[model samples]
Target chain A: MTQPAIELDGVGKRYWKIQERSLLRSLVRFGPPNKTELWALRDANLLVEPGETIGIVGRNGAGKSTLLRLLAGVSRPTTGTVTTRGRIAPLLSVGVGFHQEMTGRENIYVNGMLLGFGKSRIDTLFDEIVEFADLADFIDTPVKFYSSGMYMRLGFSVAMHVEPDVLLVDEVLAVGDIGFRIRSLDRMREMHRSGTAVVFVSHWLQAVQLLCPRAVCMHRGQIVFDGPTEGALARHHELLTSDADSAEYARGTVRVENRQLLKLDGSPAGTVQQDSAMIYRVELHFDESVESPQVLFQVYAEDGTFVYQMQTPLGESWRTLSAGAIATLDVTFLPRFGGGGTFRNVVVVTSIDTSVTYVRDDGLAYFVEPRIGAAGLSDLEAKIAIDGVDRTESRPMRFGGTWAAVEGA
Target chain B: MNNRSLLISLAQKEFRVRYKRAWLGVIWSIALPIFQSAVMVFIFSRVGRFGSGSSFNYAAFVLAGMVPWLYLSASVASSTTSIVDASDITVKIAFPRAILPLVSPVANLFTLAISVLILFIALPIVGASVGPRFLFVLPAAVLLCAFTATLGLALGALYVYFRDVKFMVQAVLLVWIYITPIVYPPSALKGAAPWLDFNPLTGIVGLFQRAVGAPVPSVRALLVSVATTLVLGVVAIRAHHRHDRLFVDLL
Candidate 1:
């Protein structure tokens, strides 16, 4: 019923790579001077509803940062339009626009104002922000004297309290220690509950999978794929493998002919159920005779976190393979991740001599759909009846989802 | 609070940070320009034999013109370079990019205000008594700030595109004082006297001199300063508003 919080209509941005930035050189460089045009984004169209959480994944030059800059209104789109309702907050890194000489308390007002919050708003939120940052003792101390973690915590706390309609978080969640990271995630989850749209961009696939339900995969300045988070991640891993394989394949002796993910019933599986067995099967063709070879299998979550790893038994010597031989390797595992998410499985083949690696393949990916009312990286499913008394139960959640918001764009 | 409060807050930060770790603190704001004025008063009045036997005290003349001159030069010099200097914030955060340049001039206002206070107090010490005519100092200060902000916003916006403008501003400010008739009255110059009347700051300094009961500048010079400030002010606001959202690209 409500208008989407943010919309980009045919948005495009281009930057010039000037050969010489100086005024004098530019004057002397004559007609059609030395410069190149780089289109950072092209025809980027997106619409985000309120309380939607969207993830952006891309390689280095895929223009994710440029898109954020445009959405934040820090940079204007060269063409097209970016329209958004209400305030847009860019979850900037620590000390952005902060005066280091000012105390944490002072910086909060200044930073909050710079981010477009009223002074009275910051005043009321000040104590809660301090408690959240856990910097009660250092509130009056100059930020320059605060540790980097403390500085980031104070920054994160103030931004978290702002109640933005749309929050653009760019890899700022990995701040502080693990505890702070979790707390920050929890706070973001809270914002999600209260109806804020979050545009999160991160290379950490696991975090992306944990938080965002939908994602857009960007490649070479355009959205190559946009759908469920797992599908986007699967597409991304394929891009990475294909990108990496082209340069490395020329020197390898063994080639991965084909790769497939199969269920326990031996049917090719594109998506699997939670707690079901999955076989990461790779077909390899050898160009040269090889002695006992070891095969390595690794599973990575959509956030690129290594979820599982195993290898063929170290001392179990498989028979030698003559030249022009084909080998089929199967890696079996039970997908323990709950709630549907993408997982990438890599297959590597190497000789026992430890001097040569035949092939390293990471192109295969599969999805696991978690059970109802389940969450987190794994489905522990802790169930017990201790002497006829049971206490394990989940109360009705005020926040309906793991992260309350639904992400798009 | 709105941008008005944000502007004041930002300026307050610039003011506080300048004195943060220094032992001399706000004293430096008063001391540095006073020290410069004292040295100039000695050199031009006694050593160079300028402004001698004049109806006004050369010391008061020098100190009065010196305070505003210092504010103009320092504010312009720093504010021109501010947008580029704070690229870290400019690149990441989204707000009015003009705020970056606007903050420094306002931030330095505290120092300018403090120095002006020191000037009023120093006037009596130099045998220049306070007069009701000194009320003109309020308009003079406003005119001075208008001139500074116009120039600052215009050049700060320019500096984002052409970084070498920073050095150009510094080079100009270094020589601007000598030409503004701070130590000697504008009448002291010969052929350049007519040209000096065209310099916008000439009337500003003249007004500052009048604020402390020194010699009055011609009406033409005062009119020129007002016209120039308004014209440049419009141009600056236009330029900055057009480029405000685009400045981050260059950074």
Candidate 2:
């Protein structure tokens, strides 16, 4: 492996919170007064070897952005030290630093220089950057007119062509379309293969899993887990679902006082296999009386898009569930979602109308790392036949669309 | 081979694209101040309100002042907001923060050059004799540009943190021309002449007027202008060096 391209030893950043803006009036306010203190990022540490692609995953306000900003040199750490070996390029949030009045060609030069290239070097690489952006015709036009996709294309092209020793990517790939995203990821992968130390920050666990073999998970300005991508993801899921203490208590006509995933023999199965049938047992504590309660549960894909939802029998009438009555509900489904990423399970207890929910829990996110080469949301068994030859499909079934044989009407 | 060429290629690219859409093409740079000079010449000649003296043509007087004033105002106004305005690229990519401020002054050089050319063309028409004294405007132009960029870089950095700086700059520029002796002669100040020496712009305008053989400024005022330019330039560079990479965070 190449030498360590980026190193941080006990590096931490502290920001001041001004009690009030230092405006003329505010500064002269009664007796020179206001308070300020340090917040966010203290005593953080990490080291990255050259050619290593590392993913950083965390919830909102987790200081993930703070860490990325430090890596990019956007802001310096208030304490500790950061040392980098060579030219560093940051592909931050989409199309940063582009001047609206400037054309694509002009921006590329300006951008290339900003990334630490001298003028002559940029001239030689100019064509490559332009070609990568696919903006041959629009290169001379003002970037204000370029669509978001074009802008991103140009930005990434310039960054990649700079041949940076260390590349910092911050959730910018989330904005592009699928094709562009694929290309950008391919370029990033190529960079990794060519010995560029990479640090990528994203909320998408799937994206993290796809690009980074090694990953770290952050929570509340602290590194919760740091290891292999798969292990980090598993720990992240455990943190999300091990609701020993969750503030988001279920609220509905019947409040879910407790919920647990269990094995077939009535033992709690905290983690389930990707292909095994499992039972999700929930206990609802009722406050007021109700006629019928429709308990709903949903599983979400890594990107937070809904995977599927199920409801209990709708028409079953129940006697008034008085206050202080504890009822148990169980749901069993074969774990079939195909893609190997984190999936969140949410349970909501509602009235028969399904409009006024008494208990709702959206915090329990689960991780499902499907077998290798599998894809999409589900693993439904199916076969394709062409000219009497059956094509046994190996990939998992992605969400949406289906094929079938139908007799003539 | 590829690395050193980026700066030259970018500067050329920016210069070419700036005038790509104009009707008169690159001539628009010269045309703007020349037209303004024509209007000033007509108004002052007919009205005789600018305290004209026999030594210098009022037409040439106004053109000289307009040249530096245009360069200073345009450079400062644009440079103050250059980084913030180019936020699209600054926030995403890693680059030297100085490039944003650098682009404006570099681009404005074209117009500054045009104004100087027009200054010469207007000189003979306005009854002024041209001589080696014309070379004096070169140093004066250089000094003026140096100061303008210094102010631009400094103000641009402040602008990233304090958004109100842009409006404050506009407000100052609105009142700046009157104080600079651009439209009228410095002698008109009379009793207030001593205080006028303290104003940095007075020396610059005095230098331009001197090139045209107008009443040359006192030595102290000229020294003050040169000193202010050097001081402001130093301050701007120091501030930018310290805050260059961090500017994007505030932006």
Q: Pick by DockQ: which candidate is best? A: 1
TM-score (2 decimals) of chain A in model 1: 0.80
Per-residue alpha-carbon lDDT of model 2 for A1-409, expressed as tens digits? 5567877777776665555443464536886456555546767778788888888887777788778777777677777787888888988877766767788987887777778777678889999888877899999889999999999889988988889989888878777677777677678767777888888888766667666777887766777788877777766667666643465564444666566776788886644567677787777788777768777789877677898899877657765677778888787877787655667677777777766777667645666655434567886644568888976554322111110111111
Poorest stretch of ten by lDDT in candidate 2 chain A:
A399-408
- Superposed by TM-score, candidate 2 places the C-alpha of residue A204 at a distance from the truth, in angstroms, of 2.1
Interface RMSD of each: 1.4, 3.8
TM-score of each: 0.86, 0.88
lDDT score for candidate 2 against the true structure: 0.75
DockQ for every model, please.
Answer: 0.64, 0.41
How many residue pairs clash in each candidate at the backbone level? Answer: 10, 30
Question: Docking category for candidate 1?
Answer: medium
**What tens digits encode model 1's per-residue C-alpha lDDT throughout A1-409?**
9999989999889899987787677667777778899999999889888888898987788899999888888888989999988888788656566677899999999888978888988899999999999999999998889998998888888888888889988877756887888788788878887889999998655567667878899988888888887778777766764575454454567877566678888897654777678787777777888788888788788677887778876546778888789888777888888645667787777878555777777656655654544656777787656888875544322233343333211
What's model 1's lDDT at B75? 87
Residues B1-251 of candidate 2: C-alpha lDDT, one tens digit per residue: 33334434554556776677777877776777778777876777678577455567777788888888888887788788988987766655555666667666777887888788878877998788787787878888888877787788788888887777888999999998877887778777778877878878888888887787777878877888889888988898888789877776666
